[model samples]
Target: MNDTPITLSRADSSPPRSRSATWLSLGIGALVTLVALYLIVRSVNFELTLLAIRSANLWLVLAALGVQLAAMLFVIRRWQILLRPYPTRYNELTQIYFSAHLLNTILPAKMGTLARILLAAEMENLNVGFVFGSIAIEKVLDSLVMLLLLAVIAPFVPMPEWLRETVTASVLLVLLLLLLLVSVARFRSALLNAVTRFETRLFGAQSTRLALLVRGVIESLMNLTRRRELASVLFWTVCAILAGGLVNQLLFAALDISVPWSATWFVMVVLQIGTRVPALPANLGVFHYVVILALSVYSVNENTALAYAILLHLVVFVLPALIGALCALPISARLFALLTNRTQPTTE
Candidate 1:
């Protein structure tokens, strides 16, 4: 008798356990922040760290920011390629991409990612599942590039246990996801049928809608395997990763942290992969922890190392977030409406 669409709203999609999990994640993030801050305060001479920051070349810092901002363009292009079926404008995607970065920095639980997916879906008249799927593909590509860098750097550098475990876990996760995609492609019909039957037994009357949503998600996963799309996506992804490494190297130079070029990969790898764990907004304590740990491997002192990490976080997270917020203001009304509106559902 009821015919309302199933929206991905907190009340509809998220069960009690999911809400509990979110609270638990927040608690973990808070604890991590406290521990990081405690360690930093105990180990580093705050005055000396401040002096190191003050002594940093202002022009070089600005140049580092510039390089990081430039790298975001390649990232946006890669995102656009993944979103081929929906076909968004270059300028619009740029705005959305950076806006998501702003959200990711300020919000917890990767909500920035969710923000972009929803924003793109709303703006482009596309299914949310499709957009989400594209984002997942982007993440997979990022993991592959990160793993490649680790492979290249592992032989020469004495990797820390944390770094080794992170890489191993990442590699296994990527492999599993790739295998899952292939399996779905090979047995699409059978998988869809199984999903439909499960939904039918679970939701009864709402099974039709749920089945359609599931099918869309599965199809989007399969789309990543298409040769042309995969090739283009991977190429841009690699470019983005290299550009990121360049940004880190420039930042290292700006802060006067002299290390080998490959050391940048170490910094990039840990920051990129380590922050994947639950942490405070903008990766807070987690970012500094990983950066200091990575730099320590190259014999950098705690005071100067913390300075580099703090400045790098500012360039990577804070400045871009500020710029992104400014650029996204014009479109904020629609984005806010989409996020807040509860009764209406965009169809699959």
Candidate 2:
């Protein structure tokens, strides 16, 4: 009998279907990238785009990079808050965060998230499900902050009809998720009892480990929802979003493009929502397309907008990857080993 806990068992279970699905997703993403690149290439003057990028103010670009780092710090702080009572060391956590950032950049489908959850769990000797739950709460807080920012800016900015509808849909979807999580957290004990009963009745005592894993996840969520933790996480989330907006503004300045702060905020919001779609690693063509779309409303030329998008991707994705490599190469190696089933995670 393999007495490994359910978390490790599930993490190591990579059946043929899963491999096929990952390849299929990558193929689809590549096709999307080619199509988007085609459209962009047809619309923009390549020379002009190169010239715009070349002419960008180097000093402002540096400033934007600095702000981007600050934004990442805010994100790390929010995650720290979610990881209450974990006793995670600041330096170690920072490395893990950026290492995950690097994985997120190169891997398709945000696999970096899983890496972070696993690494954090191992580092803190914590339950894998609990770490997963904390990350879930982090995502929920981000969605709420983005929606709030969109609402505050939409009234002042001239947004496209499609974007407005997307925002509306997003608001409803996030609210629904938030409500569901809250309900689960509120009645976690009862939920656990129900799960155990169902599993026992269906599969006998052998299946109870799954119930225990679910209980860990639910308890983590409940811990995160306590008033003090929620408030601190919310505050850091707002700071992170605002810091991201500032990076956008700085990038705009770098390009010497004069646009309202509202437009910058709107573009940030669009990028956030757009990148959530499964795409080539680091969002590739999708990032440029949405940036161009958002800037079009403000009459920014396609070439210049592409320049901005390229620079933005560098600061947002490439720089972080470099930092992560420098700081967390060993951790990343372990993450890949775990994913490949080269090594199993130790049972908690």
Candidate 3:
């Protein structure tokens, strides 16, 4: 394993967005959350919602929670598969995964991915760009899996025109990304040489490091084309999706609700897409709104749907967050110190 300390560009150390922009985003997200909550309150009978919650089967709820954790494990395994070239231990990846999850819940705009890239690179003494590339590959694969799930359910469910359009756009985007990765991997040597020559002409002495970083990133992307790794990653991705579906199924069972498997899958897909939006910590109101909307299609009562959404959120979001917080505690101080030092301006 390389023991060299990772060097980050100034761009990496600092916030990508300005403070004012971040504040504006937070304000908008808060407004959206409030609006969603207001709509939910207006539509649901709180007393009935509470009664539904109160009467839920505890064992099924516990089972759903357990399945949610299993889903997280599948995600970790998929990431581990991507980092197969690196000297990574499963236990170390578990800590980093959960810690990133903790940050994702609190941070807006999926900043948890950035945190994961930094934490994984720093802890494992790996190249920062390589870690970033692995995450990129992971996301592309996830998008493909989600699209596949949507395709499977399309025949059974009458998707709204808007959803069909969104899926069409997503399919095009994922295809473009996949093509780019394949092209990069196929011509990695030529691309690296070109990058090195360009950087050398522009930056002179500092060119080598930049070239090496690019090489690391290219190598990471190359993993996608490897048949064995691709197959393994796909398997894990499917497993994670299945595990998530089971969690949804268990939650429905807990509420004493009977919905077709396709309905459950639809809800799962909607939740996946919905929670990706910029929102309050842990997705708060946005999550519940999406769940209720998805459940509404099946003629589920507003109160019952609300009850289901709240419980599902607790299991799928809150529980992971709590576990992630615990996992992050040991590394929190070190991570903070590293970021602080990196953010400080270097003196000549």
- Clashing residue pairs in all predictions, respectively, total 0, 0, 0
Per-residue C-alpha lDDT of model 3 across residues 1-348, encoded as one tens digit per residue: 233434444334334455687687788788888988999999999999999999999999999989899989998888888876667878888898888888778876565666787778767766667777888888888787788888888888878676677677788989999898979956887888898898889879554666757766787787877899989998998899889899889889888998888987898887766666667777889999888988887889899999999999899877888998999899988666554445442322
Q: CA lDDT, every prediction?
A: 0.77, 0.79, 0.80
Q: Which candidate is the best by TM-score?
A: 2
Error of 1 at 292 (Å): 0.2
Model 2 poorest 10 in a row by lDDT: 1-10
lDDT of 1 by residue, 1-348 (tens): 012222343223222236676688888988888888888888899899999999998888898888888888888887787766545788988889898898888877777776787777666655566667778877777787788888898887888887777778888999998887778778878877987888789989564655555555665676676899778877888787877888788778887889987798988888878888788889898899788888999999999999999999999999999988987798887666554444254333
Backbone-clash count (model 3): 0
Best by lDDT: 3
Question: Which of 1 and 2 is ahead in TM-score?
Answer: 2
- What order do you get sorting by lDDT, best first? 3, 2, 1
Model 2 agreement with the true structure over 1-348: per-residue lDDT tens digits: 112323434343222227777888888888888888888989999899999999999999999899999989988888777766556677777888998888788888677776787777667655667678788888777787788888888778787888878888888989997897879856877888998999899979766556766765775677656799878887888788888888899899889988877987888889878777668988899899989999998899999999999999999999879998887766756776656656553444
**Global lDDT of model 2:** 0.79
For candidate 2, the per-residue lDDT at 74 reads 85
Best of the two (2, 3) by TM-score: 2
Q: In model 2, what lDDT does residue 84 have? A: 69
